[model samples]
Target chain A: MSFNPFYILPELILTAGGILVLLAGLSTRKWEAPGKIKPYSPEALALLTLTGALASSLALLWRPEVVKGVSQFGDMIAVDPMAVFFKIVVLACSIFVVFLAADYFQGIRVHRGEFYALLIFATLAASFLSAATDLIMIYLSLEFLSITSYVLVGWLKQDPRSNEASVKYFLYGAVAAAVMVYGMSIFYGLAATTDIAAIHSKLVSYPPDGSPTHIIFLGLLMMMVGFGFKISMAPFHQWAPDTYEGAPTPVTAFLSVASKAAGFAVVLRVLVSVFTPGVVDWTPMIVALSGLTMTVGNLTALPQCNIKRMLAYSSIAQAGYLLLGVAALRLSPLALPAVMLYLFIYLFMNMGAFAVVTMVSARLNSDDIREYSGLAKRSPASAVAMAIFMLSLAGIPPAAGFVGKFYLFAAALQSGDKTLLYLAILAIANTVISVYYYMNVVRYMYFAKPKSDTPLKPSFAMNMVVGFAAAATIIMLISPEPFIQMAKHSAALLTGTP
Target chain B: MIPLEWYLGLSAALFCIGIFAVLSRRNAIGILMGIELMLNAANINLVALARYMHPHILTGQVFAIFIMTVAAAEAAVGLAIVISVYRNAEHINIDKITTMKW
Candidate 1:
């Protein structure tokens, strides 16, 4: 097979960009005070790198060959509309996170340069993860993402909370990755190939029988445990709240959006491609897991006093909702697109929520919900944006989250399966229960009187990011035709003429 | 040649022990060692399967190599985080490292 460097242009750029940014961090400025090293303006360089990569991904989308999903490098990586779409998502995430961190690090008094380098590296890993077509590619990319995440989570080395979070995250992640690799080894052993397509064909040719049934099930479950940890699915979600609360808020935002997107991308691709629908059906299992995950996530979130922890739990619930689409993928053609659309909208609303958290925390140096009291009186703009985000998260109309949920529930109902319908109803009940906790933040921001009436002022760049995300969220809700159409097209690339 | 089943059985037993050590151990370094054991179990499976099933191809061996490389990297990072955590708390007990909780 001929190697095509053009197929991996985006990844190459990101890799070069990460190294360059790392080098930039090492170079000292001439005007620095004694004993103080002037940090390089990595935020600007990171933004430039991310934009270039994003442009390349968009260019790849326009290529006719890539539209049809071209396999490159001995079928290890796939270049398709779906891959390009996710690359775009992850790149956008990097851009916004860099924006968040650019302003955030100034407030916290931490080293800013290597932080961008790590973020870029994480983006590179996520792009590979969404495009991996072979078992080796999948495992390598997934581990790359995990290892970077472990470091990034602990970047605030001086903070005990941050260090603690990193340890917990690393311990859980290392074990989960080990279990997942074990499962992949089994598949490779049975099929004598590590390529996902080849494994699918082999499994289809010789389906597992009585004795091997246990191995297949065990393999699938173990692998899901690893993916579940990345996406923060329940029963495997013990690390998320702690990690999110302990880590720097900007890192939390990046993990919540881009990392989760990569996890969903791999989960959707592997389960859809490998299992072939009936050989070893895991939909019923997923349905039950989704229900349990959402219920647990919402119920646990209600008692959280820390805003970051609350958002963490809410993100788990959102993952449960996303999994519902995975459950409906075989039954409804719209499921995958709905999932894609939901993730896109989720990036804005959830990231916007975290952006607000970063801003408030930077000022008050607290992540507690009560610290947001009378935020509307202090910062009307941020207060309104937070309200919109909270409402969007609650799936109220005129916010993009409602439209996202509508399509997802529509997919579930279109399945016409009694169990799926019940799952949809359960999701609706979870949504209603979620409204109270989401609104709890809004209540603190609007109704409660502040201990002091000092006005809060977000920086110019922070305002720009929050405004852009808020406007996009409302605009997507009001006119979702283009975004919905794009998601459907991307979904079709994965599910074959969906 | 020894049966592939024998190799697989040993790997499975090793993996189980690894998991037990990871879950049961309280020291951070002990947990990391457990993770290494689990990774090596997978490495054993990969190498054994490659030799028995596909003697002509080197995919499984290559995968085993990559797993070894990744395990080393993970251990490096894991120990670094452990050392950093210890700097703050003066201890490395996993159970006692609870500064942030629900």
Candidate 2:
């Protein structure tokens, strides 16, 4: 249980940054006038903090000793390439969200400091979630993330919709978390240890007949209910569309990408580490989940008129595709890398789409699809970027999403398992169904007549974020070699291979 | 001393009751109460398992303590959100807070 202070520099930076931002905000509250202090002042501080955290995380990538898998502080937090990869993703997503949020929150009249502080805290929790190896660490980090997110969803305190969204999210999140803890308790009872690897070793040492297989199965199932809720998988996905639509758009974007990434991280860690092959056959269950998730998500998205709700379903569908990798984990070597690569690509394209929606909604004050009519004529650059994002999300050629989907399908097919192959085909069909709705957004932007001919102008900061995302998606599509290599390296820690 | 199975059974029953309450209750605070019950069920399991199964190591007891702390934090946030909802909608029933439909 050797503690290394330097090992968790990024988390330290975020915690300190959050406290400082809180104090800064409270001190500023004494001013009499609302517009006396510009909102950008706090936003710049947030951006600075996020930039520092990202830099620290990136610095960790270059440290060879840290890159080699080692559990920090007595196996509670694992400092490995896999954790580093997800932390980088979380930090980068927060940075991008801050940029987009700086522009979004400029119009809102809330206490800006708390919002940024909570966002940073959520990021810290997410990083902890990806790295957590002990059950206590996992539960604490998850609750930390959830608590911050609940407040962020209702940050627009005056908006009734925000209030509704937060209440629903709080209720669902609390129940799911409680269910997950119950499962953890069962795990502890079975193994008499809270360390995940220790539990796995105990399970392995005790023969299947000797151990309580039924209780283990029940616990794992209950835990999946919580993870599934976080990732917005079907049957646990009822809260997503409403939450996405009602919460602030930047929060929606954060939830869609960073939060989902953390969910997948925890799921992968637990399933691969604790529930290894030959111990329990959970693949069939994952296969069923994948099939239902993609189909339900794609089909439900078809009738949605709100852009946020449609994207919410699209993200759920994306989660199904990611789960295909998890399902094929035992059969294919490419499974972990495929999931990792997809999340990286998902960060850019999905965030790009939501940022465009934010821009449009800001201009028209509507999230309705009809308001996007002739968006090309109104904002050509944004419309073009939106189309590219739509194409990428639909898994069309020459988009990064196509490459991500390609690897997942290839991984599933290469496994040569009958069920996995069938899942791959089902995913392909879902991809086609998804295109209709994604392209519908594009159609409204390109083909539909405008209700008003007023030209929309996005802020300079927004254009930069959108442009960067679109370009990254295209670049990754064109040359996925670097990202593929990185993904493979990051995933090697989990797969236990070079 | 009583067998561990009895304690486990009692906690399991409590957890089920909590789940039932969470699903059946229309009031927001009632659902929160259900969540607390479920959490306490886990806590009981943790402490009883530690006492019966692994007397030397207090990991389960420690876990129970952490769970209690976390449950307190969760209840605080849950109640705060409920109050905000009440202020906005003039009621805490889950049914009345449906501003955003699925």
Candidate 3:
């Protein structure tokens, strides 16, 4: 099997860039100027690397072979339109995070280069995860992502909360990865192959009456534990709130949006490719999980005073809504596209919310909701942007999230499955339950009295990220046709069972 | 010759013991050990299944090797984190590390 170098250009770029950033961190010279708003070398290099990778990913989207789906690396990974789209999303997320971190670590005396390098590596892992077509590739890339995240979460070694957060994340992540690998071992035993396509073919070759249905179900359930932990699904979400609250806010944003997207990408790929409808009817299981996940996330989010913790729960609920798209995959043609669209929109809104949180927390050194009182007076631009993000997250009309949710729920309804229909209704109730907490931040920003009248001036980099995210969010709602078409175009995953 | 069922049973028991230790142990290092036990159980399963079921291919054996490598790396990182946590909290007790509510 000859390895094709052209197919993995983005990964190569990220690898080179991560190494370069890590090496750059060893320089002793000061790069920051006293008065000018210039980015240091690590930030500049990371941005350049991400931009290059993003361009390559976008180029892959237009390749005729890639659009049709091309298996690379001896069928360990697939460079399909879906993979390219997710690669783009993940790269864009890293780019925005670099900007967020620039202003975030401005005053802190820490190793900025290592942080950027790890972020790049995490992005690399996420990109690999989204495209992995073999069980080994899946396990390797998922663990790669988790280990990098553990380090990033615990980056502030001196802070006890950061240390605690990293420990919790590592403990949960290691156990989950082990369990997932065990499940993959079972699949290997059953199929005698690691390639997803071969596994699917082997599973389908079993005689129906003598099929090892119970064992297959056990493997599937075990694998979901790892995937569920990544996406913060119910019963596996205990680590999220503490981790989000304790970690630096920029890392929190990256984990919520980028990591969760990668998790969903792999989940959808595995379910659609390896466990096709003829092999295993997983729709019922997905429906139950989707309903339970949203309810748990929304109910837990109600009493959170900490802003980051609240967003953490809200992101979990968002994961549940995303799962609706997966549940409807076999029944509705719109399901995959709906998931793509929601994740794309979520990238903007969630990051925008966190960017604001990062800025506010940097100034006040507080993530408590009460600290946001009269934010409209202190920083009208940020307050308004926060309001836009909050409204969008709550799925209000005229915001991008409403359109995204509309497509997801519409996909579920279009499935014509009764259980999915009930799940969709339950999701709607979860949405209603979620609006109160999301708006609680807004009410404080607009109506509550200010603790201090001093204006909170956001730095230029943060301003750019927040402004770009806000504009993208509103514009996506206004002209959602192109985005929808992009999502539809990118939904052509390579299924093996067909 | 030992049957495949015997190997499968042994691996399952090991995995269950790992889970029990992970849930019951309060020491962070003990939990880490449990995780290692679970990983090794899977390793045993993979290698045994590969030998008995698919002797013609090295897929399961190769996967087991990769799992072992990754497991080692995981342990190193996990121990580093445990050390850092201990430095801050002055103890490695999982129950007492609850600055944030579980």
Candidate 4:
């Protein structure tokens, strides 16, 4: 019940920063003036705001109370290692996205200030989402994130494709949200409390004979529809490919990495905290979902010619693999860490790949995979970086994706559950199927004939993002111990032991 | 005083109608209205449950308030995007908004 200001410093900074950036964008002064006494460029200001938030989040990681976990604001928010970990992930992705947007939107006439402000606001929502401990907080923050994303997705108002993408995303998002609220209402009626811990305690106290297991299960299933849509799980993933293909590249990157990561963070929290095994066993359902999501995502990804669309399916498949870790949570201690570790690796590789896409599409004005023919000849640095990202995404050796997938699969196998064992094997088979499409990008980069001999020079910011991501992908493979230990430490949730 | 089960039944019916409208409607605004209906149904459930089950605390009523505020915001953004789409594609029919497909 403590209302400590320190617990929410990062959110406060982001809220103030978003408003400041928006106001700064209203000024008519030359933002790009060299040697100016006071530089007020939206990009610089946005980066500074993100850096401030990132530093505070890092500082929160070392707080004495965080190790044991503490609830603030009447138990609405939980500041724990897991929440801090996801905050760092969201902020890191946002910082990289600012860099990508700076380069992508160069010389464009769009409202740059509003774009950065919305990004900061979206990050704010995600941060709140990861830490929310009440149904009301969760619903509010999740919808906040969705509303900001709908606006961000349609930022390029002149592009018909962007307009269509935003509309489709809004429709699906609104429906999913409404259904989720309905489910939350059911929980409210059952427990008469909005706090997750309270709900769990009340459910546990109910007698076995009189407990409303069927009603609880129904509510749980309905809520899953909302969470499933966020992570782009199968059967609820209809909007992702179309949105990814049509939205601006930087926004696409944010959706794939940051938004999905936030979704998983909240999902893990709710599944572990509120739905204990004594109440209901959710493992079987998650297991079935893991298998179906991967099979559908990988199989559909094979035929996509658009790189963004292909990557959309690839991310969906990655979500499936992440779900395998979730399905094994009760049986094995390794499950939570494995999921976190994979998401950390995914942030780098996915953002790096999208950075390259942003740069190439900015220059070539095309998203078609065929247009990337002989990129090795046109831009050797970018082509090589793209190849590394593609390799990492495919879970090939000497790349971080391999280490991540190995841990995820290992977690499932260590669970000793017959179903999880079969799921690991199915996941391995799906990985094999995934390689063809991942390598197809490589084939176009190096093996295919050149469209022209002119070299494509990526801007400094784009190059830095690509190089940094590529280097991290390879370096994590070489030394994964530190990252693994970090994940293990951050696996601690508010109420449960991992 | 009304019984709690009656209120639950009424809300359930409203929820089903909302879902049906969302699935079957072709107009974008029609779909948005369906979503609003669905949210309102949840609001009714929360308010009714609060009155019947937890009379001491205002948790459910407060929750209903928050949901109403968010639903309004959602409808605003949804309509803005719909208008943007209409300006670009010259129509707001969900079926005709398909410039992208796998």
Tell me, by DockQ, which candidate is best.
Answer: 4
How does each model score on lDDT? Answer: 0.89, 0.89, 0.91, 0.90
Best candidate per lDDT, number? 3
Q: After aligning candidate 2 to the native by TM-score, how far in Å is the CA of A169 from where it should be?
A: 0.6
Q: Which stretches of candidate 3 lie over 4 Å from their true place?
A: A28-40, A493-497
Displacement of the residue A392 alpha carbon in candidate 4, Å: 0.8
**DockQ values per model:** 0.89, 0.86, 0.79, 0.92
Write the residue-wise lDDT of candidate 4 on B5-80 in tens digits.
Answer: 9999999999999999999999999999999999999999999999999899899999999999999899889888
Q: lDDT tens string, model 4, A1-498?
A: 768888789999999999999988777343442121135777778888999999999998888887778888889988989999999999999999998888777655688788999999999999998898899999999999999999999998989999998988898998998889899999999998999888999888888888899999989988888888888988789899999989889999999988898899889988998889878889999999999999999999999999999999999999999999999988898999999999999999999999999988988998989989999999999999999999999999968999999999999999999999999999999999999999999999999997887889897767888999999999899999999998988885533552
Q: TM-score of model 3's chain A, to 2 decimals?
A: 0.98
**Quality class of the docking in candidate 1, CAPRI style:** high
Question: Which one wins by DockQ: 2 or 4?
Answer: 4
**Candidate 2 residue pairs that clash:** none
lDDT string, candidate 3, A1-498, tens digits: 567778899999999999998887676234442222345478888899999999999988777878888888899998998889889889999988887887777666678788999999999999999999999999999999999999999999989999989999999998888899889999999999999889999998999888898899999999999999999988888899999989988999999999999999999899988888668889999998998888989999999999999999999899999998989999998999999999999999999999999999989998999999999999999999999999999999868999999999999999899999999999999999999999999999999999899999998778888999999999999999999999988885543227
Report the C-alpha lDDT of model 2 over A1-498, residue by residue, as the tens digit. 577777788899999988888877775552323332254466667777888888887888888887677778789999888898899899889988887776676556778778888999999999999999999999999999999999999888778998888988888999999999999999998899999999988887877578777788899998998888888888898888888998999999999999999999999999998888746779999999999999999999999999999999999999999999999988898999999999999999999999999988877889999899999999999999999999999999978999999999999999999999899999999999999999999999999999988899888888999999999999999999999999998887787831
Quote model 2's TM-score: 0.97
lDDT of 3 at A387: 97
Q: After superposition, how far is residue B40 of candidate 1 from its true place, in Å?
A: 0.7
Q: Estimate each model's TM-score.
A: 0.97, 0.97, 0.98, 0.98
